[model samples]
Target: MVRNVESSVDDVYEWLLKKGVSQKISQIFRELLAEHGLKQHISDATHRLGHTLDVLITREDSSILKGIPFVADPGICDNNGNRSGDPLAIRTLLRLSKAPRERRTVIFRKIHDINIDNFRKDLDFSSVTYKEASVEKLIIHYNRVLTATIDVHAPLKSKEIVIRPNTPWFTDDLYSAKRDRRKAERLMRRTNLAVHKDIFNQKCMQVTKLIQHCKSQFYINKIQEIGSDSKQLFKLTNNLMGNTNLSVLLEHDSEIDLASKFGEFFIGKIQKIRENLCSLTKSPTREVVLRADIKFDGIPLEAFEPMSIAEVCDIIGDAPTKSCKLDPIPTNVLKQCSESILPIITEIINKSFSEASVPLDFKKAIVRPLIKRQGLDKDEFKNYRPVSNLPFLSKVLEKAVASRLEKYLNDYQLHDNVQSAYRSSHSTETALLRLHHDITS
Candidate 1:
């Protein structure tokens, strides 16, 4: 992030340099230098807390020279014959001791570069170090601000309701059990409905308040009434609305009809508010579902045929020889088998329209396995394997493993010594292969 910021600034600087604005830019550089010099002076003066104490002590004495103690050399002789110590330093210390008591108000005013008298009027400085002030004033001022800002009220109100049934004579203990159970169930249902209604109402009210708050007139009015503590008012209002008990409101609703009506009204209002807000702002961008087509050259392949596991093993033969003796199948026969069995391969190559050849090693490795797995005899041309039996072949082909292997082999270009070793190894392997062929024959 810092590098990016530096790069952006450098770009602007370079642009300015090209435009020949170096002389004009020096004005800003000079202002920055002045600021740095002021900062250095402040840093040197307040190198430690002791330095602050010295400044405070010295500032109190109007008669003391500014640079006397700081610049005075004790080694140098003065005309006053004060060989024991630096005369200027001694005089400055004496003057500081004799000076009038320093007022914190005056010091703070000077440091802040503000008028002390006016600032004191605007702020309650009883807790601050003014020479004459009572602690009670500080407490009162602090309490007033705290009381104005903080909410100390409970938001919920509770009430109990007594329900009398339509039938009065059903008052026996057994009857009362049945009656009470029904009443309790009804009350529970009502309470739940009321609670839901209350929550919905509160949500709607919040949306309404938010809309009102967004209005310029409402914000201005609120600020005018609350002064600088409008934030406290908004927070208190939100807390009060959030804490309001919906269950209490629900208990007052006698019938389910009334509860349902109120719930619908609240929901409708919320929906309307949502629509209004959404319309005023930009509608959210819809998520685009990306899909890719597996096209062979220009057209989708109608059939797919994969190499069987047996074919794979055949291609990567377990023989100890450097290379296995492959069966000499005719090119036309192999091409026909490729077209009929390896439909997936054909599909990948865009329905045999592609110019690229199926790699010889890959065809041997993959196709044989698929054919074997499908339980098809390689010699029997009558029994061809179904394309759907081997779905994994298509996935394997998609991996581009052959391309990766080719890249790896190409990248392994041998250095001089490594090349010599590789060539020697190759020669020995070739000689062994020839001898093995003769012996096996």
Candidate 2:
């Protein structure tokens, strides 16, 4: 049943003969191997004593050992590849199959290429009128109208692309330099000129220097930005050292399940906090109020003043052009079309102010889970934190409400003088400086 073997049978026969074994015995041994569907493939002596002790044995019918040649070396080598004294060494090459290319679908809109003037014109012509209705209905109408307008101008498109590992330091400058280097190399090869050769070498050196500068600058900026955040800094360091790896999943696990698991963990955590608060409220603390005798009558804030169209336009213009998938229009598009959309947005805010209720749509947010830091168990829910990305319009409305609330607080002098958080020109740094001054004085 055996067809072939990849070992030197003739070399083994000669070694057997040199070992003083009879020719008849060697023939019998070969016949026995054939009868058993087995073959010995080691043709050369494996030991220093000229004995073929180490041999590659395989089934004659099997192709697994076929096309594989082994080199029998009498010694080992050091790090510099120089041979050192050793018992023996067998070297062989094993070629493994290439890994399959992984692909993912990217859905995006070409927001940069949009003509803002045309978009504003389209919005001016579009009807966003709604009848007197509940705030919920009005919010739904606003989202639908703006989403439809954006779809007409900048429709979403999907493309499948191969996923590859990339360095964070890679930039457009490096890409252009690499392209120029390729052109120079091609010219050098085609022309066979000394000038072209020198140009190619110079381009190579330039690219190398550019890459080093970019990598160093990337790390330097990253360290400065995250210097105050130790957790983030450690994560960046671990990623740079190549110690971090992606989370692995089992065959039965799906991304949806993982998301649900994270959601449940957060919900349970909030429930625990609520339970603790309820228990504490049932048994009140005996602490005394520090400013119980300081009583000043200040006008209480009952309702928020409605924001005007100009105020709404200013808010949108000043806000960052960061968008979420839930947003009906990208922030930049909204800003550009502010003149046309301000009236509706102003109405929505006024309606919300009079009703004393935020729209349900505004309350919705897309939550993503991220690991708290590197070197933590990725599978554990406690190690991950939830980050909510809210729609751009929701943020605009929030800024409007915060502005009114802040004005009320300032008008009555209701806030504590030493309070640092959420106050203009105040931060932990200022708080620490004040503490230091108090101690010194």
Candidate 3:
């Protein structure tokens, strides 16, 4: 075994030519490898006899494989310390492509950083201040103005944030305690003082107790939040037991295809329901009059009155600060600028009522499909339900409509007297009381 010959990139081209490859083809191959940032590591002979028989290739810029693969003596060790000259041993250490500190990008606007006074001033002078004849146009203008003003003040910014596995019980207080414990341990190690040792011991006990307390409280709160939902409770228990939450993977090539399949499944279910309804037998029946001499005393509700700015402001103020991604602005931001935008919103609501139509933006909703419960066949679309989230303005408008409709119903005595559900001051308890009174009477 002796090192006598060295092989280079040129030697590879020569070999390719010896194998009947044309000069042009060899040149193209070399160029392709170079373009892909490939590197050849085995320049020295690997065989026992001095010939470069093996090639080690890797990405030139990748940290996944560093340095060259170690070329052990071309032989296998036998039981009696004998070497068999057949295969060579190649060794390398493999590493992950990304480091632990790898960061991800997140786009968000600092809504809390916005100045309310400046925001109000900007909205007052914005294009939304001018009234549009059509409700749709007015809504579009309002959305544009609000979005632009908020963007100007808050601005959509991107931040590279590192994401790592986290425990639900790990709170800021617990983190602080751990940090103090480590500092105390370091002081004890450096000073070798009895007080420092005692402090470290105390810190260790404090951290241990905090960890147990935090973990127990976390589970307790989670169980309470889950309440009587057996599915959630079982899922939590499984998670605590280190069982995977992943369901059976559906057959699809890509995410888009998977989403399409889900859509098809839900649509097919709806179609099947419609088909069943259509197949049902229909019978024509005569209507029986309960009171032949009864007169029509209720007034017909055709249109709603335009709400005042004060009323719109009150409604907006009382509304919960919940928002959907489809909303033009955050609910809190909208509330902060309500004074400047109240007239525009009030006008839009009145125009919508007059036209008997809602803005198209308000009609659009974001739909999310969630598994109905754990321990169910998630691969089956039947086990999933669609939850739709409407924008903030949509909910506000609906509240206004509901209030007006309720007033109309109350004024005309249109509601059923015995109905207890979905009515103010009436619930299951009231329904039970009514049943008791009827039984006693």
Candidate 4:
């Protein structure tokens, strides 16, 4: 039950006395509370436990109140201090229609055109020991070109560039007023002077009003600038004040803590599995020959076919944008210049197949933990499941590989008719039908 903010412990005892409760029982209750070291709070300049209670009581609907009282900012309750991180200057890079800096894709196209000429002069593909190595070098060069393009990220977001949140409306005047309020508060608390208290209250009101007016004007301007575009407005709003914090908990609420925990879970388990595999006795392996039961003239039997400029352009045009990518230049950026870079991509793809190897960089994935159950303590790592977000380029390359392999397998009828999963035109329904037929027969 929420005790009234104005009521003291003596008032509670007196109220119980009037209610015909025994004095001995009421005294015992007070004694037990003191023995447990539990405390009721009064609001002060340094802490606001009672203020939080007042807000909750005033804001919450009476109809919804149930069970025990719950409070978010129950201040000075325990010695283990709860901390909200020092405020972060979240990036407000609002537009995707235009690059904030010189576009990396354009620079990459220019550099590759230059590099291909220089490469052709000194380095012949035929003379190159490994075509795979050459292709790898080309990709590395592409990354280098992208790296040289200007940094488009917001400067305040960078920790090294230590500018505080510089919202157009939050000015030096407001900051000075806020500082003065804090000074007045400290003076009033120490001296208990009515004059200092009045000064503090005045400063507080001034800061709050100034902040509200400035912020209201700023947001009004942004909305007007965005006009009637609902999607852009929503995106802008989300970027400005969205809950970007991941729900998962790490020991110190640090990225380093998360990484270390994941490393222990994944890498440690993999190492253990490897040790177990090594301990197992060797099993004889056999080479299974693939025979053609069905033939398709369009599908290549011996070698992978090179995708034409038109084919590459079509594929990239249908590519999903705003997806995750490890590379600085995203697939969306690449799609814009797909036609221009087709020759270079075709060369790389053809060489890649001829060499029959891909760089290990393509295997990289970002693991994000998703909460599996809501009520479980977030600090308990097992309650969450990890999801791997593959780079867009890697996914595209993987699809190309899968397409070639599936084509070859389908042409040769390499998989048995019994196979119902991991194939087109086969599903649980088909598997069930086949099972039913066999069972009856």
Candidate 5:
């Protein structure tokens, strides 16, 4: 993966040589240097926790509404209840100070198992109010099992351990080879003898070849796993190429301040949509009355019914996993699930549409600010546009709604021909053709 977007900010200073890119762009890079540290904390948390949580924050008060414990660094064992370090840490260390690496690993694993018993983590959807396997209950239960397993296996959270952006694919053997290569490089730098030079060169070359081979194999496996999904392939490439990392402004040094700044600029913008004023319209003028009377009769409707297992399977199967919306349970996993499980999933989708109510959890969105262009002012928040990420489950629910709604619209022909942009299978070319036909007519 790429080191960081702002990791090379010092090089921006050397851009004093070339007057090509504008000073404003360079300043933006400089201001973004603070994001590197924030990103380091985020990365470390992800590594330790197996999965990352989207901190529900609004700039309104600049406080995290949930999951602050997950984001904060797990510094020295004060044991204030973040499901962190052993309460008996000093005692345990005194007992096992001379333990071997293998024994230490075993001991920590036991400690982690014990920690799970004592620490009361928040209940995600699965474990909450679960008694019997109803549609929602079964779905959430399956997700809970998978989620708990993943959380159980995640690296033990720690503080200030050098957060290296080491590739997840790196093995102990490769790491050892890399260490040896570094040693060889250092030795060659210090020595002058021909014997030393030859041995160092051979050893370095072998290590270099092994490293290249390992990296190639790792990426190849990843590509095969992604398998013809161009978007996921592109995301993997971008991680290596360093494109997706967000730059944090130095003015907002800590994430807390950035959260506050972002909230200040954005929270007020979230206006509650006004109530349906049209429903309360006491009087309609002549033009509005005439327009209301003018309606086109559409193809007759069949009774609307629930989606089928086959249809549900198709929708899940076609879902693109490239979307950055992470969820407790991923759609990719859902797609690959056994056919027998499809009916339960279909039941969940059916009841959701039948009731026409979506949970508030589905509606919550995480906003990430993206810089629009090269000359954006570093100091101004307005230069950035917000791109919101939704949970994968929300998108799946959205797709279910759209499918049912589209069928309804098609049956009644309520969709206007002029709306070529959002209509399935319509394009800019179709819009142009329609315009040309109208002109000729």
Candidate 6:
């Protein structure tokens, strides 16, 4: 009866293990087993099992765990007054794991000399005590506080350039108002160069045309009187030149008066056009790329993804699996994720979340459903089954899949109406490809 009960308990423990029960629960079970003198039986049962079982049962179990009071040991002080290799002291220092060896050594030396009680008192956390916290928890708390501090001060650090008020020019009372007006006119002209350029170009062309027309009219009227006295003609031409000069001076003054009156409206219109262009340039636009790969029993077969030059470099460096499996198909289907299929999927998920403007937790929501639908564990790749010897059909199906994914990603709009369309399209494409392959075989 005792043996049967022991077996039953073991079975319950195994069931809980499969369900991913907490370490505390597992430890409690182990204690119960030890109390029943079934520890020997468990040892025998787990003799052939991997060491992972032992580690999990020991380190992860909190029920049998006792909190240890951290004691400070004295030593020499470094520049930062932090100690090395001591987890508690390291946590107190808030030093990054990736700190330089020299820096770490200094930190270690400094922390080793500190009096724990006095240090705690110095911090003056009367409301909060560092009494019974693990190294991991301490590190996490420090990081949180540091992050909060940075966030609070971030806005003040961001200095934006602004236009300052113009200083008034010093002048005599007689010409001060007139001088100020002239200065204002000059400032306006200098600032609105594009508007002035357009106006000047247009008016210059108009003036040139008017001068040509006048010259043409004079020549046409005298065409039949070519034999008239040359001296008399020269005198007449000089008089006409004088009259033209006077007329041009009057026209110039009139144009300047017109500009003084209406220049603001033209300049404002130009400025508005520029501001519109600037806003358009800064507006967000969707940039989509389809990346897909087919794997045959975990080994990548074909990979393709339409990528820019910078993306290509990143893909080469980070995604070696993609480099190995070059896509053979000539279709628009480019295979993308080849290095680690999981990371590729994660990248896709991230892109989707970003496009949707949803929190990253949505990734977990989508991933769980997809994993369940596939009836595969998150780490279950060992049992992956490859499609049988239908090389041509497989290639065709893969290409079709790529094409469908590309089209969907490219056209997907993250609006309420079309948000699910990409996901639906992907599913449909995969299903159809599977069906077609099955029927053909």
TM per candidate: 0.12, 0.68, 0.62, 0.48, 0.49, 0.11
Task: Give the per-residue lDDT digits (tens) of candidate 4, residues 360-398.
Answer: 666677887777876778777667677888766566666
Provide the clashing-pair count of each candidate structure.
22, 1, 0, 0, 1, 16
Candidate 5 achieves a global lDDT of 0.58
* Candidate number of the best TM-score: 2
Cα-based lDDT for every prediction = 0.38, 0.79, 0.80, 0.60, 0.58, 0.38
The digit string of per-residue lDDT tens for model 3 on 79-181 reads: 9989875446566777755456757999999988888898888884354444547888888888888888888999999998988776888999999999999
Which residues of candidate 3, in runs, are more than 4 Å off? 1-103, 124-132, 164-177, 180-203, 213-253, 264-295
Q: For candidate 4, what is the TM-score?
A: 0.48
Q: Largest lDDT belongs to which candidate?
A: 3
lDDT of 1 by residue, 1-441 (tens): 335333334444455566787856945743564455421111112212212111222223245444444423346555886554322232234334544543332111122333334322333223433123233332233334322322121112344434433332222443544454555556656787776565555555554554454444544665577776877787646743665322212223366654465446555666998999777565566444544343223323323333344433333232222211222221222232332223223233332113234433323321121232343454432232222222222223443434333334445531232232334245666667767888999
Q: Higher lDDT: candidate 2 or 3?
A: 3
Greater TM-score among 1 and 4 belongs to 4
Q: Which 10-residue span in candidate 1 carries the lowest summed lDDT?
A: 39-48
Q: For each candidate, C-alpha RMSD in Å?
A: 41.8, 9.3, 12.0, 16.2, 20.6, 43.2
By lDDT, the candidates rank as 3, 2, 4, 5, 6, 1
lDDT of 5 by residue, 139-182 (tens): 55645654564355443453433334667777788878778777
> How far off is model 6, as Cα RMSD?
43.2
Q: Which ten residues in a row are the worst by lDDT in model 4? A: 150-159
Output the better candidate (4/6) by lDDT. Answer: 4
